[model samples]
Target: MMMKTIKYASLFRSEAKKVHRSKRWKPIFNEPLPIEVTGSTQYQGLAPFDFVVALLQDGQSLPSYFYVHPLTLPRKTRANIARALNKSVNEVQCLELHFDGHNGDHLLVYSSDDDANILYLIAIGTHSDIFG
Candidate 1:
């Protein structure tokens, strides 16, 4: 597997550090949302995905939950993204992906559940699963 770079927001890094220091999972899970994807995310750059990949790509399995400010991505055709993620679009925000150790993963390709295909871009992972 190609190793993608992981760039963490300062706030998230700090929060992670604090959580580590606190010696607990609840604290980490309770952390406020991470930075909003702005200028960088506008270009369809893989940065957002890369960040998530970096966060959980190690041999160990760690679940991560993220929130994205919704963006309408009609231009982001399902076919193209499916080709990229190597998965098929199940519904508006649902797609199937097989990521090495992470199986049965669904990409809320864009977070909004509405019909406009608004991509609120978020990846969720829990104790038994990962959504990156």
Candidate 2:
């Protein structure tokens, strides 16, 4: 199966800037959004990467669309996040993170493949740890 690359990483900076610039920045939901899915087209689950993009893009409608799934950040996004956290990209294996669709405090737990049980959590966007 060919994997289609999602460009959410590149958009992260811009989205962050928008969020930082305006306290009242609301996402426009009028545009049709693209969401990725797994398995048969008819029977599929939400793609984690796509879901993150949707969250970063517009979160107003997340309750209707986003869900808890195994989310893997793309290579580019992983690298970007590593840089943001001041971590060495090679030492960080953070492609996978969890979003329960109800929490605003998204925890990005990065596990180092070189070492087991070594986890780092970087909080992004808004919300506290509601998943716990």
Candidate 3:
């Protein structure tokens, strides 16, 4: 009998860790935008990364050839987020970070459901995190 391939979600745990360590800077804006944090996919439980990428790309309507997912994020750091999505890092107080999409870009979006524990991203940037 042939066996089927099972996708284990465990491998992603480490990738997820990389995101958390990254610092989420406060947006330059004086006020916080009306955004929420979540763990559910914003796109009806489908892939929500695209929506996030759109917002990150200055809210472009066109589709992209790549898939972006959020591995981790801190609170209220949306301004420099564009750089993080691109898998590049920003420096402040001598710190660099990466967005671990498990080999894909990352985005932040809102989820309709409300039972999630982790925060949700509505966009991504060109930043990558390393050693913190």
lDDT by residue (tens digit), candidate 1, 13-113? 44444434443343223332233422233222333334334333422222233332233334455444444344455443432222212432322222222
- Give each model a TM-score: 0.24, 0.24, 0.20
For each candidate in the order shown, give its overall lDDT on alpha carbons: 0.33, 0.38, 0.29
Task: Write the number of the candidate with greater lDDT, choosing between 2 and 3.
Answer: 2
Global lDDT of model 1: 0.33
Q: Over all chains combined, what TM-score does candidate 2 have?
A: 0.24
lDDT of 1 at 4: 32
Encode model 3's per-residue lDDT on 14-72: one tens digit a residue. 44454445553222112222223213334222223333332333332212333332344
The clash numbers for all candidates, in the given order, read 2, 0, 28
**In model 1, how large is the Cα lDDT of residue 91?**
45
Task: Give me the candidate number with maximum lDDT.
Answer: 2
User: Which is superior by TM-score, 2 or 3?
Assistant: 2
lDDT score for residue 60 of model 2: 20
**lDDT tens string, model 2, 39-90?**
2432134344344443333322233334433445567766875674456766
Model 2, which residues run further than 4 Å from truth? 1-10, 13-66, 90-132
Candidate order by decreasing lDDT: 2, 1, 3
Q: Tell me the deviation in Å of residue 119 in model 3.
A: 21
